[model samples]
Every structure is written in structure tokens, then in C-alpha cells.
Target: MRLRDYLRINVWLLPIILILLPITLIIFGSSYLSTPNTYFNTQLNDGWSVSHGDNHYENVNLKNFNLGNTSKGDVVTITSTIPDMTAPAAAIMFRSILSTVTVWIDDEQVYEYGKDFADKNLMLPKHYNFISIPESAIGKTITITFDVTENNAFSGISPVYYGNLFELERSYLQSKRLDLFIGIFLCLFGFMLLTLSSYLYMYHGQDLSLIFSSVISFNLGAYILCYNDLFNFIGDNDFYFCIMEYVTLYSIPFSIIVFLVSTHPELNTNLAKVFLSINILFPALTLILQLTNLVHINYFVTALHIMALLEAAILLPRLVMNIYRRYQSRKNSPDYTGMTSDSILIIGLVVFIFCCVIDIAKYNFFNEFGGGGVAYTGITFMNLGALGFVMSLFVFYFYHGIEHINAAYVKEHLEGLAYTDPLTGLMNRAKCMQYMATVKGNYALISIDMDNLKPVNDTLGHLEGDRMIRCFSDILKQAFDGASLIGRTGGDEFLVAIENPESGICEKMIEKLETLMAVFNDADKKIRLSASCGFAYSNEPKLTDANSVFIMADTRMYRIKEQHHEDKLSKFLDDIISGKISQKGGEEGT
Candidate 1:
């Protein structure tokens, strides 16, 4: 409920948001109001030209333009020259015909396509030639040859040449260095924000679902802008933006649903079910559209991203408000409360929504208003949501964890009242069976019976016998403190189990019982009570279950009590017979 509680979780998440959110704004949100004037500057690197007169056998379609074959005579001439030759960067070009496509610079075979070139380099694709010429190849005249070999595919057409994209050059030299450096700077800074955010989620024990989703968003951006040339790192703009496009595609919807589910725990189950089903369906549909190229799923995703952000904006506040109200009522009442957790969660959700909306507005609306200056809000706000998410999850998990511990305590305490004997405070017969059902391992079960307990009840009254029962149960508790379980199975009966069967413990315990009997009567007016105990230890796992152990102990105890009773009866009969014989003899002699 208080601000200190919010900070506990917020402390970790803030730095990440401060770093990443701003980057999100600068990279994507920067052009929101207007495109920057700097975007007008385009540095051309791999620019080449071919006149209509330059080709001998040319096809209107550029596909496979470099290679063609004719049975008798096939020829195509290419006039090659490198721009910025003094700059010392090799300009690469390639041509292919039939089985062979040779690459040349400075009039020599720098790379051969579809040949032993595979052995020389592992990076080379087996089916295509992606050649590179060193900067040393510049300032020299170059001749290229694409000799037709076997001509199995196209034996009768002459070779032709076509244009390629501008990529073969990179400049360390700064004709326009400041502008380039600035763009790179923004990107690096943005990347740091993104990385910081990810670390917060992974390290702070936050929910990984949205963390992973946001990570995918960041990855999408890097994939589009900063990958290597093997995938045409600077391919046609259409293909090059695919990664960014897909990033928006999946992450937009994913982020929305993750926010909804994590932040709203009390939604109706039916509504949640429907929403979750649709969530799965939407992603799958989008993936299908992408893989098949059935339609440009990017368009839907981008449009949906804006919509989803708005929905999150609306839903997040409502949920937070509800959590706050509930927390206020429950804070100190102890019914069930998690004010700090709810507050952190609400704050994170609200700030994240606001940040996202601002980002969207900055990109689509503000960027269009003018060049990049008026439009793009630079990244710096990421810390808000980053910190919020961390705190929210911390609170969320903590709330649940504490609730679980309390529940366990309540259940155990309540169960003791229900199943335990009131007088002895041991488990009753019902509890004995329950314990037998519940417990396992090697144990010693002791079944005790007071010798001639009914006669004491008859002579001294039931109250005195009851006191004896209570005393004996207390003795059982003392004998097996932490070593075993002592429970009142029924009237004058106790059941106990000890782990790993220390049978010597039984002897010491029985001796203590005898000592209690000797001292117990004088203080209580000459009422003597002795108990016989039978116990057995089973080492076998299968035989060590409670029921089997109890039966064995009970059987052993009965045998000891029966033998003592027989000895006492025999002595009493002998005394009576001797007394009667002496009396008859004395009477006859008189």
C-alpha cells in the first residue's frame, strides 16, 4: 500500500527501463511526428549502370541475367569500372553461364563459381557464388570471363548482363562521417536499453513470458537493420525490412495478451478461456500467413500493434484501480491482503501502457507532422516499465508464496483439533488409522494395557482410573519426544512409531513406565497401575507400514500381559488351598 513497498521491486526494474524504453522511442518512435531532414542523405555504395547497347543477348526479366549459352556462338560484353577507385575498396561483380560462373576483378579470376572453390572456402554456398575482391584489386583494369560448360540447361542462347545492388563498398573515410556516426550512436544506445531490460527480467525473477516477448521485439529490430551480407544484409528494401516487420508482427499481439493475463488475475474464467484460445489462434494464423507468403501479415501486425497498445492502456488502469481498492480494504484486516504487490503490479502495467502509446503516437502521427526532429521522441523512458514489471512480478510471486505458507499452517493446526484426543492430546483411534495410512518407514508400535484396570475402576471409582489413563499418556509423550510419534489410539491404548527402529529405546521407555508406577500410587492414595507394552521393529520396507507394525506390537504386548496374569492367579490358588487344609486338621485334633 505504501511507496516503500513499491520501491522494493521497482529498485531493480528502473535502470533497465531508463535504458531501453528511450531506445525504443528513438529507433522507431523518433520518426513519429516527422521524418528527420537527415534521412534525405543517401550514400550510394554499389551503384552500376548498363546501357541498352551494352548487352548482346539480354532478357527483359533480370532473373538469371548473367548466364546464357549458345551452341555455336554466344557473347556478351561488359564494360567494368569501379567508382571511388582511389578509395581502395574492391568493387565486386559476377556472371554465370551453364555450369560455370566466374568472378573477376583487375582481369584475373579472384573467385570461381561452382568449382573447387568450395574446398578453398567453407563460407561459400555450394550452389551460388558470393565473391569478394580485396581493396588491392582497385586502380587496375579488370577482364571477366563466364565460359559456358556443357550447356545442359540453356544450350542455344547468348549470354547477357544485368545490374546489381550497391553494397560492395564500406567507408572508414568521412566525406559525410558525422551524420553516419550519429545514426550508429542512436542504434547502439537503443540496443543498450533493450539489453538492460532483458537483464532485469531474467535476473529479478520476473515473469519470463513478456520478458521474452519484449526481447523478441528487440531482436526483430536488430535482424532487420544489422545482419550480415549472407542474407543480403542490405537486400532490396522490401526483403531487408522483413525482420523488423515480423518483430512487430508477433510481439505486438504477444505483449498485449501477456499484459492482460499477468496483470488481471480475477478475470472471468469463461472470458479468459475465450481470450486465450483466440490468442493462440491469432499467432498461428500469422505464422501461417508468413511462411506461405499468402499475404503480407506485416500490415495486419503493424495495424494491430497500435490497437493492442490502446487496449492495454484501457485495461491496465482498470485492473490497477481494482487491485488498489481491494488492497485498501484488506491491508491490515488479515482476511487476505497483498497491497504492496498489487500496487507494484498496477504501477508497472500503467506506466508500460502509457510508454507504449506515446511511442506509437510519436512514430505514426508526430513523425508525419514534420521531419524526424518534430516527430521522434528519443529513448529514455524504458526504465519506467522495466522497473515496474520487475516490482510487479516480485510482489505477485511474494503474495502467492506467503498465501501458501499461511494456508499450510491453518490446515495443520485445524487438523490437530479435529483428530487428536482431548485428554492426552494424542491422536485417537481414528487418527491412529489415519497416521497409519499417512506415515511410512521402519517404526516401533507400542500397544499398552493397564493390568486389571477394571478392578481399579470398580474399587477406586472411574475418576481415579481416568487419572491413571491421563498420567500414562503423559508418560508416553515424555518417552518419545522427538524420536517417534505418540498417540492415544483408544481408552488405555497408545500407538507409536519410531524411525529406523532403535529397539533399545523401547527398553529404556518401559523402565521409565515401571518407575512412574512405583511413585504414582502414594501421592494418589495407594492406587497402583502397571502397564505391559508390546513392540516389534520391522526393517523391511514393505512390512514397515503402520498397520502391519501395530498388529505385531499389539500381539507381542498381549502375550506379556497374559503370562503375568497366569503367574498371579497360580500363587493366589496355592495360598487358598494351603490355608483350608491347615484349618481342617486343627478342627479334627480338637
Candidate 2:
């Protein structure tokens, strides 16, 4: 009904709208945009023949072509007729994995790769083979030979493309634009998370979950870029990028485990620790073996898949159980709120694991049944799943951060209320005693007592007395602006403690107090402001601690107060005797 209430109720919708509006517009606008079509290139998916050691297949479908079984050093030869091409610069393009390739256009050699790697006993990395076709080669039979370099590596062949070289490359990159955007976005997001988490850890002592999340995000992003061969834009070193791909991939599970454990310590079970240890060891061992030429990292794909499945088997159930228990325990409580960050995290984890299962299943399924190809031209479900998981982690991190900040704010506010005097905002008596009881080092304690407080209360009311006390407290604050401590110790009683006071500093503060009081009294005629103050340094003889110094200061302050009283009485009597002032109702002049 009210504007404030409406705003309060709908404030959360603002971010949702801001996020969804752009997405909706993009979805809507995309329908009107022209669809991408091949202008200068064509996919050659049919009319291919394959020959492998005593076996020959005719009219094989190149799009889903595969050799049922293959061994290291096995050779598979494929031949296809190049269609008519009008483009001046022509080429045949396809991707190869873990294989050395040689291309011949009607017996004239046109392209070769991985011969050096094979000679050196190194793994051949996956690469896009773009063989330039001579203008005279049109209508000629194009023969390609794949020398499989690893067991189980020759799963299937990528669909061949023939046309203008640059256009084919452009189309290829254009198809990968979404994946590129996501990969780069994720890397940048991870860097931003690292920066923010580092600051929070240094200043606020936050946990390492944010750091782990950042690592996971960066690794996943790198893995995406490398696995898709998009990182070739940055560098043409396919071998190093292949290593990076596996390294980043193997590193992810460890960071994920660490992040989960950091966020939910309850998840740090023995099984999780074992998984963490294996995740740590697997990558290092694999990398060492690869570098030593004992075994290539590509051969460990099945092992990594098994490890992931095992981890998910142990973690997913426990995570779901943990979320269930937490929700059940808190559901009926008055403070209950639906869907905690942990719940969101579990959901994200489930979705991520699901996507991984799909990818893994697809890989195995196609290898067994659908001609052994696992490449998707556009963004994969794994990428979308990873993005969702990372977003969930961001939500979890920020939710807890905001919760911590709110808790700290409430604690500080409560502490302020407990220690501070409501009227003058000075330290209360309890806080003063607490400070004095534990105070260390050399210091001077000044005891201050306001004069004529009771008389002001009797004549002008307690409100005026309170005003006088506040005025005196302000004077004390101004006099000892940066003093160690100032407090209202009792009614009309105040104390100022200065640590390591300079020579004559105590006297100077007392003089300043008197001057401020004089100025305050001159400005206001309602009540004369006066206070007797005496300070004793801790270095004074026989002053063992703050309490002793305080006692000495109080004693000296009483002596000053007695002198003021005596002087006031004498002045009043002098005035009365000289007929300058008169007593009212036989009362003594104050």
C-alpha cells in the first residue's frame, strides 16, 4: 500500500529483471537475425572410402566414420573426390586427434603433420588439418592418411570441408564464437574473484572457498578453450596447449573438493579427503609420466573418467544428504528462510555432474555405436553446466560475505551501546573500570568533579543539571582531544587518562579545561560551569598502577574542591558584609 513497503517488497526483483531482460531481448532479437549459411565451403560427408589393413569399406559416411578397433602405429587411409570449387584459394579441412597425418591430392603430397613428434616418441596433439588444394586439383581424388599414434586414439574422423581456405576458417571460428565468449568470460571472472577474495582474506580473514572457486573457474575456462582448439588463436603450439588442457582438467576436481570442504566443513569426510589426495596425485603422476615418455596423458582419459565417477558416487549422495538434513533441522525454526546458498551449491553440483555424465556417456556411446566421434561444433552442455555452477559459487560466496558483514555490523553496534554513555556518548563507568583494571604502561589519570551540580539541579531542575554535565563532558573532550581515554565514571564525576603524557602535558590539559569551561560559561548565562581537576602520573613516587594514580588524583581533586568552596564562601560573606549582595530566606549564598 505504501511506497516504502512496496519498494522493500520488490527490491529483490530489480536484479532479476536486469539479468533476465537482456537475455529475453537477445532471445527475441535472434529470431529476426539472418541464419548463418556456408557461402564458399561445403561439408563433404558422403562418397568416402576407407582402407585399413585387409579391410576396405566403400561409400563410407565421413561424418560418422570410424575404425572399429585400432592400435598404436596403425594406418587408416581415406579417399574422397574433391567437388567443383570456384574460390581462388581452395583447401580441404578436417580435424585429427593423436595422429600423424599426410594428405595427397592425386598422388602429389600437399600436407603433413606430426612426423617429427612420431620420430621423437612424443604424443601427437589434436589439430585442425587445413590442406591447401591446387587449382588444377579440382575433380581429382584427394587421399588422406592417418597414422594413429596412441591406442584407442583413432575413434572417428571429423567431417571434411572443401572450399575457400579463409572462408572455411572464418566459418569454423564463427561457429565457435559462443564458446570463445564463455571461455574468455569465465577466465576474466575467475581473475576478478581472485582479486576480491585476496583482499577479503588479507583484511577480514575470510575462508579460502573463494580462492578455490576462482581456481576452478579459471581451470574450467582454460580447459574449455584448449579442448575446443580455440586456444590456437593465442598460440599455435598444440602440444603445450594439449598439456595445458589435461593439466587444467585434472586440477579442477581437487579445487572443487577443496572448495566444497572449505564451504561446508561437514563435508570433509575421510572419503572426501581420499578423493582430494587422489585428485592431487593423479595429475602430477600423469604429467610426470608424459614428460618422461613412459606414457602419454591422452591414454589416461578413461582413468580420469573413472576417478570422476567414483568421486561423484561418494560426494553426490553425501552432499544431497547434508542438504536434506540441514533443511529438515531448520525448516520449522522461526528464522527459517528457504533455499540457502548451500542448497544452491548442491543443485549446481548436481547439474554439473549430470552434464559431465552426459558428456562421458556420449563419448563412450559414440565410440561404441555412433562411429566414435565426440566433437560438437557449438557450445556443449558441459560448458553451460560449468557456467551455471560457477555462477552458483559466486552467489554462495557473496551471500556468506554479506552475512558476515551484517553480523559484524550488529556486533559493533551492540558493543557501542554497551560501553557508551547515552547522554554524552562517552565511555560508561563499567567500560572505564574495565580499561583501568587492565591498563598498562606509563600514563596520567585526571580526576574531574563538577561544582554546583546539586545547586543547579535544586534551582533549575535535573534537566539543567544534565545539561551542565554534558557541557562539562564536552570541555573534557576538547581539552584532551586525543587523550588515551575519557569517560563518565559517575554522576557529575569524570576521568581522563593519557598514555605516555609529555612533560607539562597534564598541566596544559588542566589549563585548557579551565579555559573551555570559562568560554562555555561566558556564552551561556543559565549555569556557571566549573570543575576541579587533579592529575597524577604513573611515574610519581609510590604510584604502582592506574588505580593508585587515580586515587592520588581524586585526593588532590578533593583538596582543590575544598579550596574552591572556601573561596566562594569567603567572597559571598565579603559581598554580604559590604552590602553588595543579600542572602535569600536566611539561606547561605551559594
Candidate 3:
């Protein structure tokens, strides 16, 4: 295949390669290099004990070797022997923890986390920490102990890994690269959508759907970033992190539902409103609670996720039903096309829903697998679905807009043709009548009849007669610069209307017409142009409308024509008697 054809076929792969492929490779490559070694996997589940507040560590061997939920001010100490690995640094990776921890190596405090302002805000996100093993401690027994003062989830500690610090950090990045990419991808993509939407709204037409989709994208990006462990390297403000986490998580579904409603406004039913309220109200309540330190997010994460899943389940089917009904109605219509954005949206939602289900399972049921190798979860699926759906909807919006613009252009052109005079390029009689019927206020009318038009056609051919009419139309337009309407009313007849005409405007127009006729006659000696003109103003009580003004003007025009004919007859008699000119044929008398 040609390069163009190949690219066209694989266009969707571009984003995946650009945004996600590098992270995937890093995950697998690091996992391969960091497979468990004998020294790194040394067992530390035994010889552990616990004590209450303000107590030094004690060695109590427990049957169940797990750090169960530790209350505030509770301390946990684990005594373990470190093998002589002779490594530069040792590290401990916590699969999941909700407590502040302090680690000591051989009576020396190596690292302490989660202490701020006398341990008032002491929650720490799950992460890996490094402990430097000094050269003095190698080949000697080292005491490792940590205190877990608080926790909200898994109230106890699960298995921890003692490994090379470099290898552990590499593994940590590999597992986090997916979420990191997703967070960055969402932020960047949302910004792009906002820019595109602004351009479209300004230039093409306003599409609220683009705006809503951008909102969803930004909300979900923030939601993922709040959970990203990389933030640990940035700050230790647990309260801010917790508030952002809950707030952003709550906003995601609410924004998505809002986007759906914007796309299909017809679906703004009571049921949708209820779903919206749930999505918005719960998160908002949760955010308030977190801000006040009234509740921990772990208390409501499962319920909120269930709400998100339910919202998706309900909203998708309603969307499908709406599309089905619309399709049925349009199937018999002329311009009907097949499935629309709704179908593509359903597919995207399904992808998103599937990923969500998997993530719920990963976080709730099979939670042990986290902080290990990279696991495919909702983040991947959500990104896939959001990109597909938003892109499809954008294309649809532009497509519909283009179709409407083209249709309007065609209609406007047809209307122009209907109301225009073909030969003279002036308004046709139809337009003139319509204008007169709709116009308000005082107006003036002029009725003009071309003189000797039939004689010109007979003597100089029909082409010259047409040229005379065009020249007459141009002079009429130029003379009546501000006329409300001008048209070729009939063969050899023209009419003009001017609104609120001053007393002198009509006399000035007639004088101007005579001047233009004299000028044209002087130049075009072969085809002289002249016409009988009559004018009337409608400001008086007797002439109440434009039609009445036109009738009076037309009557005056015929009377003027008769007077011109009588004058001509007398002039002919004088010319015959004086022998200055000769009348030729019966045509001259006629």
C-alpha cells in the first residue's frame, strides 16, 4: 500500500504511540530487569510486635504476621536481619498504606514521612521509601522498625519488600508510568479540546458539547493526578491531597453526565437529573466532609464508584433508545443517514464501563496485585473511550454544521433567482409587490413608461431594444439612489418607491432623469433613450399607502403620454407645411 493509504488506515494508532506506547515499554522493560532476587525478597513477615502510645518497640512474635489497622498514637515494630547484600542502598516498597511511618536502620533514623505540625495532618499516600545502609552496618545484624500511627484502609500492613533502592525505584516508576501518562494525556488533550471548541464556537457555530467534553476531560485528568504516587516527591500536604482527590474524583462522573445531556438535550429527563444529582451531590458532600476532616475518602470510595457504574449503565441505554427512535423516524425521510454519534458514543461508553469494572475489582477484591507489576486498569480504558467518543462527537458537530451552511447557501441562491429580473438584473415585479405590501410610513412613487420602444425594436432590431432597457434601468437606479424599491414592473414599464420623500425629491429625480436621457441620446446616436415619467408623494391624508401613490402616479403618466402625442401631431403638421421634413409611411402617423 502507498504511505498515504497506510497512514489513513492506521490513523487512530498515532495517539496511542505518541501518548501511551513509551510508558508501556518502560513498564515491561523495568519489570524484566527487576524480577525478584534472593537478597531483595528476604522474608520480613516474622518476629514483629506492636505496642500502644508513647512506647518503645517490643519483640512479640505474633501468629498472624500482618500490621492490622493501627489506631492513632499506636506504634508497630518489626525486628528483621538484613542479609549482607553489600548494596549501596536498601528500600522498602509498601503495596498500600494509609499511615505515617518512620524507619530506623541500626539505631540511626534513616527516613521519616507523614509528620506535619506535631502529626496533626499525618496521612501518607502509599509509596516506596529508600533507606541508606551504611558501610558500618554490613556483615552485622541491623534492626528495622517502623511506627504506623494511623490508617483508614487495610487498617493493618500487608507484605513489604526489602530490595535494592535503585531497583525498587525503577519498579515504582514502571508501575506508575501508566497513571502518569494518563494524567498528562488527559490534561493536554483537554486543553486541546478547549482550544478547538473556542475556535469552532467563534467561527462556525457554538457547540456546547465540545465545551462539556473538555470539562469531563479536565476533571478526569485531575482525578487521576490526585491518585498518582509521583506527587509524593512534590509535597507532603495530606489535607490538600485528600481534598483534591475526593473533589476531582467526584467531578469526573458529574461532568461526563453533563456532557451527555448537552449532546442529547432531549435526554434531560427526570431520571437523568436524578443521576446528575447523585453524581454531583455525593462528591460535593464528600468534598465538604474531607475539607472538614469529618470523613476519610476510603469510607466512601466503593459507594461512589458504584454510583459512577450505575450512571453509566443507565445513561448508555437511554442514549441507545433515543438513537433508535430517531433512526426509525428518519428511515423514511429523504436525507436520512445511518447510525450517528450516538452509536459511536455507546461503544466508547462500553469501553469505559468495562475498564471501570476491572479497576473496581483491582482496587477492592484483588488489591494485593497493586504496587507490583503494571496492571491494566480503568485508566487505560477510560482514556481510550474518552478520546474515541470526544473525537467522534467533534467530527459529527463539524459535519452537521457544514451541511447546514451548504443548505442555507443553496436556499439563499434559489431565493435570489426567484426575486430578480433576468434581463435588467433589477428586482422583479414579485419583489416590488412584496416590498410595497410590507413597507410602512410615508413614501413616494414614480411610474415610468419607455417612449418609442416598439419603434426602436422595429428599426434597430431586438438586441438594441434590450440594450435600451438595460440603460434605462441603470439610469433609474443611479437617479433614485435611496429608493426603497425599484423593479421592471412590466414590458416597457418601470416603477420606483422612496420612503418619507421630501417635496423636492420627486422634481429633482425627474430633472435628473431628463438629463441622463439627454446624455445617453447624445452619445448613442443610433439608439436614442427617452421615457414618460410621473411622480407622486403619499404624505397627505388622501394617499394613505404606497399602492395608492403608485396608482395616482401611473394615471398621471398616461395623461402625460397623451399630451406628448398631441404635441407631436402639431409639430408634424408644422414640419409638413414648412417643407422642413417629410413623413415617411403610414408608420409615422401611427
Name the best candidate (by TM-score): 2
Task: Candidate 2: list runs displaced more than 4 Å.
Answer: 1-11, 14-39, 203-206, 316-347, 376-379, 437-444, 455-464, 474-484, 498-509, 519-527, 536-556, 569-590
Better of 1 and 2 by lDDT: 2
Q: Lowest summed lDDT over 10 consecutive residues: which window, candidate 3?
A: 369-378
Candidate 1: minimum summed lDDT over ten consecutive residues — where? 38-47
The per-residue C-alpha lDDT of model 2 at residue 541 equals: 96
- Model 1, position 370: C-alpha lDDT score: 25
Residue 440 CA displacement from its true place in model 2, Å: 5.2
Deviation in Å, model 3, residue 284 alpha carbon: 2.0
Error of 1 at 476 (Å): 2.2
- List RMSD in Å for every model shown: 14.5, 4.3, 8.1
lDDT score of model 2? 0.82
Q: What is residue 224's positional error in candidate 1, in angstroms?
A: 15
Question: Clash number for every model?
Answer: 33, 0, 6
Candidate 1 TM-score over all chains jointly: 0.48
Q: Considering only N, C-alpha and C atoms within 3 Å, which residue pairs clash in candidate 2?
A: none
lDDT of 1 by residue, 1-590 (tens): 43334445556665685578557645543335332321112222222222222354322222223222232123323334443333222234332323345555655666655444224221112122334445565445434444333212232212222222223222211211222333344345445545765786778667544454344334333432322112233354333344444544454445445545654656434655565565556666765775565543433544566557655655555666677777777666433433355565566556755665665565444323423222122222332343344445445556555654554665776788888788878877777787678876566767777775688789988887787788777766776666556777767777776777664877777787777677766566646667778877766355646678777889989898888888878887886787965676688999
Candidate 3 residues lying further than 4 Å off, grouped into runs, are 1-96, 106-109, 115-128, 137-152, 155-171, 195-207, 234-239, 330-339, 368-378, 403-583, 586-590
Better of 1 and 3 by lDDT: 3
